[model samples]
Target: MKYCLSFLLVSLFTSCKYFDVEKTTSEAILKEELKTFNWNDVDTYPSFSICDSLISKSEKKECFQNNLSSHILKFLQDEVIVVTQDIHDTINLQFKVSEKGDLTLLEAKVDSLTVKEIPNIYELINNSLNTLPTIYAAIKHDQYVKTEFELPMVIKVE
Candidate 1:
């Protein structure tokens, strides 16, 4: 009788499902819920007015960048910025687009010497950015979030 009772108790305890420690907790679920998504892996790229109707992600991104560069180049041409010397420099432009489609020029990293040599450079860039039409902000995780962009432009003066 003692042996039978002991065997029954051992089997009952071993077969119980309550001791499973692999169950997920609310905190673990909450952490997963609060995870952030990488901006580079966004479903859609930010759009300009000209590229807003494009269906493909790559097309939209390419079109937006092309249009922006075209606008800047056009502005420079209009300003008649003649390259007097043979100099090569890359300018890094940092800007932001708001959720409401407003665009802001954060900073421009141009050679100070170049700027000194070419007066009105800053003004031209600022004016060009201000003249740009409203831009559709990038969508991340289905939300229209403000996004920052870093554009590197190589300028070759001949």
Candidate 2:
């Protein structure tokens, strides 16, 4: 009878060490992930071939934006736009970068004056993107994602 009790006590004390491991709940794990999650941010912005060589995130973004702006500006400058009135305004050009890196013009917000002077300004800007080199979609968690961008273009003509 004494031997049985000793065996039971030793077994119970030895089992306590196995139960010492801390248990994690699913809700706690989910909460932890949420705490570290980025709500509306991407790991990497959509990249262009010209901008791809950049190592820094801000540099890549700047290069992407500048390259796009330069392309549109060059296209606009090449066209001889004759206006009777001295026009100075900004155009908010909105576009979407698809999962396949296709740039689609969503909208062009231009004042009535600018539209009247350059009726085909939207078409011209859209065409500039069409001529762009290959672009890669944005990356988030190692997956490609679509993104939207709005570029404010200032038009100052004498």
Candidate 3:
């Protein structure tokens, strides 16, 4: 009886480590970071146009109108230029939400940006992704659903 009790105690202790382990992907990390901002609490949610037909038709017009706004358009253009110029000569970044509620960055391609620039762009993208309150609000408001989005942009030299 003593031997069985000891074995049970040992097994319990061994399994404790596994319970503490948080298995997460990069996307999840992003989502958690975004949650830190409590974007849902903000008023005047940011808006965007829906290019994806999969989104509900009722929200499509609002999404498109939001996309045409000067603020968002400038932000998108600036982000594309900064990322491509600082990270790679050719930049392609894919953003998606993981099932665990984190942002996942995939298909990152930089043909010519320096090694240092690559990390900078990654940091920039991560920062931008995390702080997007408007986008998060839009999703929560049912203007958009959680899904993979592909946006291709170019950086024009001055």
Candidate lDDT scores, in order, read 0.78, 0.86, 0.50
Estimate the TM-score of every prediction.
Answer: 0.73, 0.78, 0.36
Pairs with steric clashes in candidate 3: 27-102, 27-103, 27-104, 28-102, 31-103, 48-63, 49-63, 49-64, 88-113
- Candidate 1 lDDT over residue span 36-128, tens digit each: 545456677678878867889999988977888778868776776665666577888888878777777798899976786677777888888
The 10-residue segment of model 2 with minimum total lDDT is: 39-48
lDDT of 2: 0.86
Candidate 3 lDDT over residue span 17-115, tens digit each:
888977899999998888776543322222332445435544663563344333323554576443344332445667664433355567656554443
Candidates, ranked, lDDT: 2, 1, 3
Worst window of 10 by summed lDDT in candidate 3: 40-49
Give the per-residue lDDT digits (tens) of candidate 2, residues 24-131.
Answer: 999999999999998678888888888877898889878887888788888888888888898899888887888899888899999999889888887888878778
lDDT of 1: 0.78
